[model samples]
Target: MTVVAHPTDPTPARAPAATRTAGRIRGLDAARALAIFGMVTVHFGPFPVRGDDLASAAYRTPYGRASVLFAFVAGVGVALLSGDGSAPRVRSAGRRLVLRAALLFPLGVALQKLPTGVAVILQYYAIYFLIAAAALRLADRWLLALAGSLTLAGPMAIVLAQRAEPSWFDAGGNVGIRAPVALLRALVISGYYPVLSWAPVVLFGIWIGRRDLHAPGVHRRLVACGAG
Candidate 1:
C-alpha cells in the first residue's frame, strides 16, 4: 500500500503522518502489539509467580497462539508487498529473505545460550523463510497442496523417527556442540513450528494476499472463518 492523508475534523491538534499511516491498519497493529506484550510476559519468567499452573498456561495460551498469528500475518505482508505474479520482484524479495535468514540463524543460536531453554523460534523462522521463498514461484494450488501435505506429514515423520533405530533424526538424545554446526542442526530440528508444518500458514497468507481484501462479502467470510 499506498498511504493517503486524511483531513482533520474540528480538532486543533494534528496527527503526524506516520500516525495517520499507522491508523490505516489499526487492527493489525493492535494485534501485533498484543502479541509483543504476550511475548514479554512469557519471557519475563515466573519471578513473583511460581510453578507451572498459571505460568505454563500463559506460556501456551495467548503468547504461543499470538506468535503463530504474527508469523502468518508476516507471510501475508510479504506476499502483499512483493506484488502479484511478478517473477523478478519475487526473486528480489527472496534474496532479501535469504539475507535476513543468514543473519537471524546466528542470532537465534546466541539467544539459545540464554536461560530461556533450548527452544528458539528464530532458527525455525529462518529455515521457513528460505523454504517459502523457494516455493513462491509455484501455482497457488500447488503451493497450498505441498504446504498442507508437509504439515500433515510432519507429525507422522516425527513419530516414525522416534520409533525407528538410532540415527541423525533422533533428536531426543544428547548431541555434540560445535556452535556453527550446532546452529545449523538446531535450525533443522528442536522447534515446535518446524518448517514443514509452518509453511502452510505462510502459503495461506499468500493465498489471502492474492485476493481482494476489500471485496464485498470477503471480510464477512474471513470473520466467519476466524469465528469458527
Candidate 2:
C-alpha cells in the first residue's frame, strides 16, 4: 500500500532588511537626547556657582559625560552610514563623511575665533569623521583591535610628546587657524578632546553599531553591559 504524503507548513515571510533598518532605535534617540540636554546644561549653565544647588549639580553631572556620549553616538552614525560593508556603500559613506569633515573643519575653526570661552569640539569631531571614513573598509574585529591599540598607545604618545615638547602642550587656549602647524598639533594631542585618546570611543561605537542591534539578544546584552 502507498503512504499518503503531507505538505509542511510554509515559513512566515519576515520583513525586508531595509524595512527593519529603517526603523529607529528608540534607545539611541533617548541617549542622544540626554546627551544634548547635558551638553546644554554644561555650556549654558551659570558660571561661578553662586551657591545655587541646581546649577552646581548640573555642572557636576554633565561636565565630562555629555561630550563622550556625543562622540559615541557620532561613531554609531558612522557605522550606520557604512551600510552593510558593501564597496559601493562604503564609497558613498566615505564621500558623505569626508564632505562633513570638510564643512565642520572650517566651521569649527571659525567658531574658535569667537570669544565663546568654551573650547569648541567641532574640529576634533571633524577629524573623527575623517578617521571613521578611512576605516570604513575595516572588519569589525580589526576595528576593535585598532580601538584598543589606540586607547593604550595614544596616552603613552601624549606623555612622551609632552615631555619632548613641554612648551607645545603648555601653550593652551585655542590655537588659531592661521597657524596651521600649531592648530594641527592642538587637534591631534593638546586640545581639550585629543583625537588620539578619543578615537577609541568612536571606534568602539562603530563596532557596536556594526552588530545586529535589532536582535533582542543584542539589546539585552547591551543593556546589561551598559548597566554594569
Q: Write the per-residue lDDT of candidate 1 for residues 1-228, one digit (tens) a residue.
A: 111223642211222223323324544566578778776766674423456687676665765676677677767666655554467867887888889889876676567667655456776677777876776676555666776787688667656644773354544212233645544443444345556556677777655554455444556766787789
- How does model 1 score by TM-score? 0.71
> By summed lDDT, which 10 consecutive residues of candidate 1 come out lowest?
9-18
Flag clash pairs in model 2.
none
* Alpha-carbon lDDT, every model: 0.60, 0.79
RMSD of 2: 8.9
For model 1, the stretches where C-alpha displacement exceeds 4 angstroms are 1-24, 45-60, 165-185
lDDT (Cα, tens digit) per residue for candidate 2, span 1-228:
111223551211222236336779777898899899989988888443767687687787888999999999888878778766678888999999999999998888888878878788888889999999987778655777899899999989988988999888775538888889988998899877898889889998877777666678778988898789
Q: Which candidate is the best by lDDT?
A: 2
User: With candidate 1 superimposed using the best TM-score fit, by how many Å does residue 98's alpha carbon deviate from the native?
Assistant: 1.1
RMSD list, candidates in order: 9.6, 8.9
